[model samples]
Target: MFWEPLRARFTREALTRSFVALRIRDYRRWSIAQLLSGAGAAASQIAIAWLVIELGGDGIALGAVTACMMLPTLLLGPFIGILVDRHTRRAVLLVTAVAQMLIAGVLAALTFGGALELWMLMALSLAHGVAFAADNPARQLLVMDIVGRERMTSAVSMNEVIINGARVIGPAIAGVLLVVSDAGWCFVVNVLMFVPSIFVLLSLRPVAPAGRTEPADSTAAAARPIGAWRFAMHTPAIRATLLLAVCASACYNIAVVVPLIVADVFHADGGTYGALAVAFGLGALPGAFFSATGPTMPRSAEVRAMAVAMAAAVLLSAGAPTLPLLFVGLAAVGMVVMWFIARANAFVMLSTPTAIRGRVMGIWAMALPGSTVVTGLLIGGLADLTDPRIAYGAVGLVTALVVTLSWRGLRSAR
Candidate 1:
């Protein structure tokens, strides 16, 4: 069903070593750029979610929009991975940043002009997803370029720190903007963040360690997506790693359900919806730190254990009878969620050979946000027809079962 990380106690030595990757200049620059870009992305997500709510859209509309946003990752993933291996990562990221900025700018104008229709938002979501399909894997490969193999796990964990940091700051900004202004202003903030991020990206150069690099092959035919997918499946570690991502993918994406919770269960406003996300982001920081101490190659047992912990946390949230309890449950979920993802990513990246790493990572990405194409419907539909709580409970229960049934298989390797 699902699997991921849990390991060595949080010793003082582990704590001190976590931030070591930031000591590298290029990684630091990349982190800052990612922080800005990730924040803008997060803010726009909040804006989009709020817009759906404002538009009188139901769970079905929410699921469809989410599906559109993630679909390109599934459809374009293999081809994009091949492209990633063939081209320069920084150039791809720059192009994506500019494209996403334009998309957000268009939405801002539409919002200001009072011309946004639900179909328009869905179409834009598709366009934005197409850009992100290129953005996600290229940025991931770039991290390896900056940090190299030895430090990749810690670097990835730190990257998760930046992402969770963005989650905290971005939604908080959106919460305020949405209250004082509207989604149009939030989209403007998205546009502004991209401008500086593009400049930061332009200023940096990345280098890989000798002999640890993906070969200098510039041909798309040199590293085929199909060959990569075959490698991932035939290899025990990668196959299991991909499976764990699928299992965990079922649990998170609470954004789709959070609004439904605030409106249907808590009878709260947009601000409360944002506050719940803040609790989640806060919890993720320590979890990301916990993951930072792990080796570049993760342990399967630990992966399985962490997946269970994450599932239990989701089920806990499902049973929350009060708003405060809901916050606690979601916080617990955030903790395990980041912890698992950081380790899982490290294992996948380290386990694969550099030649096909891009393509395999593409398949891996599909299991993540890409898998959301199918999951958005399941979770959103469950909430739509029944209570939102059922959606949460189903996610938790199904994930736990997947892990339990696949216990022996997950114990294999990467």
Candidate 2:
């Protein structure tokens, strides 16, 4: 019985991994654009956060700013998904990238002019959030079209590496740039970085649109958007993966808690925070690179491995005591988190039909930022009341519980 199930699953997994559209040139161009876009996004985020703090904004303000940036994924994502299905994805991405550049340019101008305000900052963040909501689904859907459904899993895994690889450098670079000049320079860099993506999108030869057109009837077209959520909720594998992801996000927020711990508990300074982040980044890079090499087991097995890894990371974070110990723990955590992300993304890409790919991905995006935002607020409050260590430890416990409960669903996905 086990043999039969394993064989069947392997067949499906193999089909998912095979790339039918790899010969296409435009797709490669799109991938390059996406890689640059991810890097620019990371740079912009680090810069914006630092800008808030430098302008006398407190933790609460920082949280609000982060929330504003993510809130659109929850609010505008569904409709954006609909638009992605209805519009040319290349056009959509091109417009959004340009819009993002303009938004950053405006902020850069305000900062240079010394006219930036709390409300203006918040408003700009919200706009960026909206742009993100539109941008993400377009990119995800375009990937499917570019690579075809077969190789989507590998493509997604590789994409995660590209994005996170940029993340590893973006914050560190932002730190140095902020020290050298000011937040305005970061925004300026972001604006210039986005230009490459815009050029790539514009230069791509036109292909047939991958998205399906909406029905002529308003009610019919409106009815389709909500179905994506309904479908995800009903799918045991998808639902479980998302639940696991939420837990994973909570566990991953240890990165946030670590800096606070370094300052408050270890009585360290900025260098300590940088060291921990660097260690985490170093560890995550290898993990992401390994994930791109291919599945450890079958695809489903890989998914289950991610769930197990997440649990391990949570426990590691909770058990860390010394600064060196915590760095080691964080490195392990980073490795696992990277693996889990690659596996989870591959699962989603493999499982979803191309027609509804963007909306399904929108649902995926919703779970991540929504969980991160909630956990960030919860952890922030807990850290203030007791200690960052205790707060993160508690969150890790919660994360472990979530992973344990969701193991079966993950197993099925493989």
Candidate 3:
């Protein structure tokens, strides 16, 4: 049956992840650990947003908190990349998971004691940011170490699917828990969920990075703060993917406009927001699944498909008249967004050597967060001038132009 072959192929891709990287035992262990860790991270993020709202946060406060969570990636990600190259990737990941678990515990305590303040929230956010800046590069680099390079695209896509799968499950559970008790319980659950990750990571047999390690007593490591940037700029495919990330992120203000359209126009509430999130998550899941399977299509073909989908999704969202219609548009947008991200990350992993994979991915990390920050500020100002709907429409137009102008560069990179 057609279904049998499809199922067989997917099973092969999923089960053979370690084979692709050429180290099944280590990669399997690492992948499981990452899945656990990613779920906890997603849950914790949802908890933070809800906690802020419960404490009377306005849009600006929400923005500030979100920015705090993101700013480290923008500011310190490059330096973290250097660290990823210098240190043991597995050790870096373990330390980060432990640090994040501790942060969650503190947040839980503060919430339980009714002593949580905006400053405390900001401080915890900063701590999480630092941990994330290091953890991201470490994890990306680990894909290379455990798997090598044979099935990198599969590994990258599967990793995303695992993360997004958690995204889908985490929020629904958090929502139920948030209504049943305080947000602190959400944090507690996150701490508990992270245990499996820490355990799995520890269980993996240690595999050092494939290249030369930096010397323990070197001023050289101290001097090369922006070394990741230098490395990525020198590598054509990595640079191209980073640029694509920037453009895609800038165009993603359609997400920002979703709540505005629902609340101001359709007169909806928080539940509607959750539905939109779920819709988007469900739409994106399939894209990740498809990419995880082997493909006869050129990488360029995949990227162009993503670009077209993004353009259409944006245009549809801008013109959506009702909540239901808007969700369909947002979901379509989400599907393409994942496609673009997973493909770009795959490209980065393929192009970079194991030695510098972390640094290169760190540069990729900087592009999306930095562009989102800029785009958020611009969209906020535009919302003041006109309705968010119109502002979103204009963004869609700009992104379409991005597809037109940037497609060739991306194609060349592949």
TM-score of each: 0.91, 0.82, 0.81
Q: Candidate 3, TM-score vs. the true structure?
A: 0.81
- How would you encode candidate 3's per-residue C-alpha lDDT over 296-320 as one tens digit per residue? 2337656766766777787787788
Model 3 poorest 10 in a row by lDDT: 13-22
User: Cα-based RMSD of the predictions, in order?
Assistant: 3.8, 4.6, 4.4
lDDT of 2: 0.69
> For residues 51-158, could you state the per-residue lDDT of candidate 1 as single tens digits?
988898877778888999999998887777656655677788889999999999999999999999899999999999999998987887788787876676668778
Q: Pick by lDDT: which candidate is best?
A: 1
Q: How big is the RMSD of model 3?
A: 4.4
Off by over 4 Å in 1: 1-13, 205-223, 235-237
Model 2 lDDT tens row, 164-273: 66666665666566656777877887888787788877776545575465456668657666787888887878888788777777666543466567656888754455
RMSD of 2: 4.6
Of the two candidates 1 and 3, the one with more favorable lDDT, higher being better, is: 1
- Each model's lDDT comes to 0.82, 0.69, 0.68
Q: By descending lDDT, how would the candidates be arranged?
A: 1, 2, 3
